[model samples]
Target: MDTELLKTFLEVSRTRHFGRAAEALYLTQSAVSFRIRQLENQLGVNLFTRHRNNIRLTTAGERLLPYAENLMSIWLTAKKEVSHTSQHNELTIGASSSLWECMLSEWLVALYQQHKDLQFEARISQRKSLVKQLHERQLDLLITTESPKMDEFSSQLLGHFDLALFSAAQKTTKSELKYLRLEWGPDFQQHETGLISNDGVPVLTTSSAQIAYKLLQQLNGCSFLPVEWAKKREGIYLVPDSTTLSRPLYAIWLQNSDKQSTIKELFKTPLIAQ
Candidate 1:
């Protein structure tokens, strides 16, 4: 099967329009249509249900979505490995911005001390993109707060980190404190509504913990931050009686990836133990 066909199918499914998918893939609309037709012919089933102004996946398309993603990911990984000519081991690690801000930098430094010959590539991406890269074997390991839903991926509990409310101001009054909302995860979202109450919505909201940390300092607003980050910086005082949220971090990787042994070795190091 041509990977191009699957690629085109995925783009179309994502955009829900052939023309849009063509534009994104730098192909002509007619070429995109032909690819879909070729795929449908090979599969002997219609993947999409066409409409006057909209398009949706059929039951078969829904089932094929995950398979197509996995297939492409494996193919890309194989191509990468075959093209490698370096003598040293190469590993690509991806993590959310929050995780990077929290401990990945330290871990990388510790990893290099033990394995000086290894080459490392670091990527800061959101959870969804990280999952896609892992599935495609583009990333060797992922350190994130959320676990992958796919069965082909395995996750290990790294550790639990505490998030404490920090304020630049001396007073701990909720009404007087300007709030900066930080995107920890779904669990934090549900837990926060009841934990802290503000007179109005946050003056600023950000998904990146680093951004929130800086903004909290500059804007003099309060936000929940990793205990490790909060402790490093001076002038940021913990809010009195504010609830501390515990978030679990996970190291995730593809189950049968070639880098599994390397990942295990890295995990065994003191870097992850911290």
Candidate 2:
């Protein structure tokens, strides 16, 4: 089995869109389609549901996903074990959207200055998938809010961010108990009396914190987001501090890779959480 094809398959599974996957892999749509067909023909199993513009994994594809991941890990491990000396260091890291603050830029500059031979790739994504990649040895580091378990992976408490209610600064009507906001989880949202709904159900509903900020700029309604994410809220107060919410964040990496000091150096930097 080709590792590249398997990688493409997993990428498609993560994104759930073919054109998007093609763009991500730098392959033409036809090329990606042909590779899937080739893999299916070689394995004597169909792997994807075909639609003109939509694609989904077939039952066989789902069954084979885990094995494909294991196979890729085995190959990478073999290559590392056989390497006679440290020739080059290539590191890939994943981060949740929250960590793309000013710190990311600073980290890259420091890393390059320290390790001229370093080649780095980074992506922003959801928590579960990033953890899976870290466990599989596909990613060197992961920064996220939730904890993931792995024997070779170590977790470090990074910092915290407060999730607060926000609204259009100009539109806030002084109604404390009757406003709508994004719901993260019950720990932050439980027993709160207010109007809350998805951002798009009413054709104006939005789930984006950026959009919430914009709405707050337009005075739409209050929304939920990282407290430090506010700029205009300097004067716009939210529903009393009683309803303010915050969650802890974590930075994780494979324990076995700490021998590479550049990767370790990134974690040493204070990550601004909000």
Flag regions of model 1 displaced more than 4 Å: 1-78, 84-88, 272-274
In TM-score terms, which candidate is top? 1
TM-score (all chains, Cα) for each model:
0.70, 0.60
Please give, for residues 1-274, the per-residue lDDT of candidate 2 as tens digits: 6888888888887777778889999999788778877888889999888786677889999998899878877888667544514534667778754454423555667767766767777776666777877776567778766666667778888777776665545434335323444433334445334334322222234334454455554444566566666644454456443356567677788787643466556666555633
Q: How close is candidate 1 to the true structure, as a TM-score?
A: 0.70
Q: Model-by-model lDDT, in order?
A: 0.83, 0.64
- lDDT for model 1 comes to 0.83
Candidate 1 scores a C-alpha RMSD against the true structure in Å of 5.0
Q: Across residues 42-81, which tens digit of lDDT does each residue of candidate 1 receive?
A: 9999999999558999999999999998888788878876
Model 1, C-alpha of 66: deviation from truth (Å): 15
Backbone atom clashes (below 3 Å) for every candidate: 1, 9
- The collision pairs in model 2 are 166-223, 167-216, 168-216, 168-219, 171-219, 180-195, 199-205, 199-206, 200-205
Query: Which 10-residue window of candidate 1 scores lowest in summed lDDT?
Result: 79-88
RMSD of each: 5.0, 6.2
